[model samples]
Target: MLMALSAPALAHPHSFIDMQTTLVMQQKNLLALKMVWTMDEITSADLLYDAGSAGAGSEIWKKLAAEVMARVMAQHYFTNVYRDGKPLRYMRLPSEYQLSRNGNKAVLEFVIPLAQPAPLAGKPIIFSTYDPSYFVDMTYKSDRALHLPAEATPACALSLFTPKPNASMQAYALSLDKADAPPEEMDLGQQFAQKVTLQCQ
Candidate 1:
């Protein structure tokens, strides 16, 4: 639900997000995650236009932010955490969240708390974030875009695993025009999302 725009002149991924993530640690447990998304200029422009004359932190701005947050919530925050092969749960609402501007771009920052902090020394922890429709391509610039709590490092580390969409998958994505959406059952975006694997030494 990120956008309902004009037919794309190109394939899927009409929008993009430059993301940075932090693994929040409490003692030896994974407590939460801090996510920062810097949106592309084109997407930022549309968002700003919707904001109108709303000043920073004003009621109007807050309302606008809430609307956007609602979209993210509806999509389950576009995030997932897993241990072994099973999914981990998150709090219904982020412990903290905000939508604002950074120069000509839009920035969203949020802290997603785990329902129950999982210990770092056990099963492998895999995490990923992506838009299911694959209308937007979310990426991390590099491993540098991922971080560990100062207290968690050395003992704990994260490795990014890039996605490799097969030729048919690529073609399917290319076939989607702006208005066309894949079936909900496809879970297309996750197929293209970069995954992070966490392990404590």
Candidate 2:
């Protein structure tokens, strides 16, 4: 459930939350991840997702959202090769998926397709999120040492989101190319923790 909204912060009524790594696995050598996203009081809520119903403003929102998601995903991998660049190629989803909502919480799920199938042996996969605002906040990050059995195949990946604060705003701006600052140099995990601490205080 959402806490009582403070009037001052209400100017940015919508917030985006980063979901921690919940599960990672390999099926027949392929790697899959699942993620979720949510928001607050965002207008034309239909435009709130990477792909969804759009308002007259929906096209603007869609473009901004795509850029942000692409950038954040790149930062997590410690590369600027965004979406379809080398090292890691961004797998395109249908772009019409809906965010899962329950009361005040919504889940934005992101799936990343690995460049190669997970090796039969264990390997390290680094996952991270960064807010591209004045502070370049990081919401969550973790390094998963994955053990892939011989049978692992390419499977779906997932990540989750809740409505924290400034998440979607940052994403929205990136989608629109109106971000206030370049992404920070600090590692995504440290940057995100610092941003949250600063905001919560």
Candidate 3:
């Protein structure tokens, strides 16, 4: 009998930031999202998000937020209702709202607000992302490593900039695939229960 050891990569859930998407009625005509990354310095960042027909921060922001948040939070997460970089409220898992850019090439070193599920806390979320209209590839490296076709690899992954006044949000859709699965899922519920038990001990 032959024993197979390694599993395929695509079989695992891709990791993207588990963020709560929401909207803000700020004076500026912009759209934005907030989420913490394992990297303290986001050398580059951008939202390959949608810009509905209206373009940029048009009536499209709210509409897209609602749509995207649903996809992200389907696994059980919530959106944070914020205003001008401060916490204003908390929307249930899968909240939607407007987005705005406060800075560029920003470096953020904050703690995650919520504790991850039993085995997910203190781990990293690998954001394997891609979009047709907008691209946000910060590394700007070849796609061979990611097992993607050269053409499929995004050229503008790091195109971090605020949306224009009359710009419509990118019409691209968002997909979230958890990166940490096999190694973690081995004993997920059990590991989580052990963590709780250890905490009480």
lDDT of 1 by residue, 98-198 (tens): 88888877888889899999999987899999998888888998999999978787788789999888999999998988778899999889889999999
**lDDT for model 1, on a 0 to 1 scale?**
0.85
lDDT of 2: 0.36
Lowest summed lDDT window (length 10), candidate 2: 192-201
Whole-model lDDT values for every prediction: 0.85, 0.36, 0.24
Model 2, position 132, has a per-residue lDDT of: 35
lDDT of 3 at 61: 51
> How many collisions per candidate?
0, 32, 33
What digit string (tens of lDDT, one per residue) describes model 2 on residues 1-201? 122111123222224454433333444333444444444333214434434433433555546545546544444522222121224343544223333444434344455555455432333233334443323222443322222232232332322232343675446434433223334463222323321100000
In candidate 2, which residue ranges exceed 4 Å CA deviation? 1-14, 22-24, 27-30, 40-88, 94-96, 134-190, 193-201
Off by over 4 Å in 1: 4-9, 52-55
As a TM-score, model 3 comes out at 0.25
RMSD, each candidate, Å?
Answer: 2.0, 11.7, 19.3
